[model samples]
Target: METILSATGLLTPGVEYGRVAPLADDADPVKAVGAVVPVQTHSLNVGVLTEPGQSFPDTDALITRLRGVAIGVRTADCIPVLLYAPDIEAVAAVHAGWRGTVGDIVGVTVSRLEAMGADAGRIMAHVGIGICGDCFEVGSELAVCFEDAGLGAFVLPGPFTDRLTGEPMDPDRRHIDLRCANVSRLLRRGIPEANISVAPECTRCSEIAPGPCAASVAGSGMTLAVGSEGKSAARSGVRLPSWRRDHGTTRRMLTWIRLREECPS
Candidate 1:
């Protein structure tokens, strides 16, 4: 598993696992590794996040103030976000696919952390595995979300030709850089640039590509299918999958942003 390290200043460090699925129900969900294990096993004795006989709820994020509690997010293509606030010693793990991104869940989490007494600067954020801008092709309407989020410039003109196909990318087809968008959001929230880091890998482009590139196509297809069903279906159709879909990419990107107070002189 590829993991990113934290910059020296923040004491609460985290690792983002690329291409790894949360242990299936048959697997142990709570085995902590690295810094998270000691917290999970010794200090905070909590059950694994998954529940028996129920699909993990459509929860795209988890936050814990319990030291040694390891919070994990599973992603095939969607972005997994990990946040740590050294001052309060709290950590949050988030899953941001297009809907979550547009909903601005990351910013919401940041606000929640602040409400919990975490200084925005003392918080170190890591945006993990997901599809990249070039690899993600969506519609103009979808593209507007990023623009609305202030990352419009990252959108490139396309017929973003598919790496596998020479066909012109659809006009409705918009390529999204989930990581860049999130990083932009973090910076806009006043998180310093030097405090932020991004992974260079694209799940779609990696050997561990989460699923068939067509998974996005399938997801979009499903959205369209749901739209045909009814108004409610249409409204819900636009939402991103809460769990792993397709064989989506799994390469994790680990980067960090630290607050001024937490920064090392």
Candidate 2:
């Protein structure tokens, strides 16, 4: 009997991306690889790559054709975009923070994948957990950044608050949705909408107070934020996100994808 322990349904049947969980001590999430998988993680400095290893540098994404080696990115309020090409057996793990979104990291990654013989129209993409637009309030400069990049629709008026005072804020300050922006990038690059999946849960709002973990909350469906949805959270007794700075927490969620070695005929 095949007892499915953790079935995320994120990847295809043969795909080997691990839906890992971070430690209870507020550390980065770790994959389910034993001492066998030749997996590698990067510092996720918002840069792109064609290699993988533990070199903690200024890179934010990784792409590789190496089988059995997992590549992952860490995030809290940032978007973790994973791409896979079944034709070429190539996989990519990207960390798309707000800055990365402005820099078109996801688009750049698609270009890199296309360079490696990956058809943008055929590749599968997944936009993982991060802050939602309603929860991610930003300054004018930050909001204009995405608008300048032709993602004006994603930049909307989100709930704004004084970061220092933690009080009600002006309704004018715009909030940016990194997930939507990245998705737009993928669409602009010719990736089919049917080939992409976006996780609808907001990192800050998904956590339930004295309740279920990410798996359970995700098992349900919710998308709220810290300050913006305080009343709702208090009423529902929701927990704060792991790495949500708004909740005064420090932790990261890991998103990974790997290419399994082809079997010998």
Candidate 3:
């Protein structure tokens, strides 16, 4: 059994490229090595934003041996995992939602990076923005699925009392910690403790909180839905523009990772 640990500020900003228009005049947002874009919205807008005539074409995870080429993975409630292998000087960004998790996409990505000569032990992992355990309530079947994946334990029949409160809690609402789960998975793969980092905030929980902070509750999920949804729905134009743009920005926001050969004892 591997002991899961969190990262402590070794990752740094490589670069940022907006997936949308008004290219920031700094670095062409289109050709950044690991750029994050909406999963939906098949538009010439994205094409135009990217470098001339260069199209990624239906890729959720992007990895590169090319330095200064930052890959990105867009997510709201889903897990955005960024991996870096210092030994090979390569990196990968993965989108692992419940569906992706069950598919073992994270493991597959690690394997892919290793195939490219990345040392698993030298890889640093970051499990970015998504729903937290306390905020994400799910069905028993789904809970079991996470357990099967080695991310969590099976929930048993009970009142599901709050561990902190020592009071009965709702049985129907069991919170799943997707970030911690992924951290466990990474540790199992031999990634060191000091190399992994997790965002302390939860989008869904923050959304439901009172006031201006609460105003953006639906933003994350909405953004992800737009990109992951098919062409018809995304192209329907019913979705808000901010959702589209924010999804693109979320791909560029905080959270980074760096793999180191010297382990901290």
Candidate 4:
């Protein structure tokens, strides 16, 4: 399993987190990994999904305080963000597809964390594995989305081949770096650079299970290990199984986080 190390060291002594690698593609994440029961998961749409009532329609993010209740989001090339707010002992799982990114989903989630009394200085975030900027080619429209994100680096020239004319297109196609874009957004919101950890893996180019299929949006959640703060974890979805890849097989790995019951201080 590809894991990211935290430079901020904000996870409560008891907090722990992990992601499903290519080989872990199984029937259920909870059944396979979570040792807890009654975990609450939601069906994700786009744009900061949430489940106030559980699997709520059009919801993309959720905040929970229930020690054993786990929340997560699914994604193919989209970014998955898990937040830990030590003060309120709450966590947030966010789905940042391109549309959601443009809508400032990260900021919204941060705001949600704040509503629960999270402090920017102590908050920890992980920019999970997803499509990097180079692998995610786009058009002039999405290319310009960088302006909104303030990550001017999000858009870049990608290989452009014209199928109809049998020639390479001019100026190249554009690619969007979803990872940097999200990181930039988080930085703008005051989440310390030290507090955010970026996954070392990239789903678009890696040979691992070649997953989060066109239809699968793999996802997961957050939690502390054992100490003064609290605990939590994240797990989530793959694309919904689309035919975009024609003959490609569909697969999705679940990434999750769980907060254990706090230890007696």
Runs off by more than 4 Å, candidate 4: 1-12, 21-26, 30-53, 158-171, 208-250
- Candidate 3, after superposition: displacement of residue 87 in Å? 1.4
Q: All candidates: CA RMSD in angstroms? A: 13.0, 7.0, 12.1, 9.3
lDDT of 2 by residue, 54-146 (tens): 343567667777776667776767788888877777788887887778888888878887887888988888887678776687778987777
Mind giving the per-residue lDDT tens digits that candidate 3 earns over 99-196?
A: 66666667777877777788898887767656656545678788878778665652334445443246666877656777777777677777888888
Candidate 3's clash total is 9
Clashes of 4: 56
| Per-residue C-alpha lDDT of model 4 across residues 105-127, encoded as one tens digit per residue | 88887877776578876777878
TM-score-superior candidate, 1 or 3:
1
- Model 1 steric clash total: 14
Whole-model lDDT, candidate 2? 0.63
Q: Roughly what TM-score does model 2 have, to 2 decimal places?
A: 0.72
Minimum summed lDDT over a 10-residue window in model 2 is located at 1-10
Ranking by lDDT: 2, 4, 1, 3
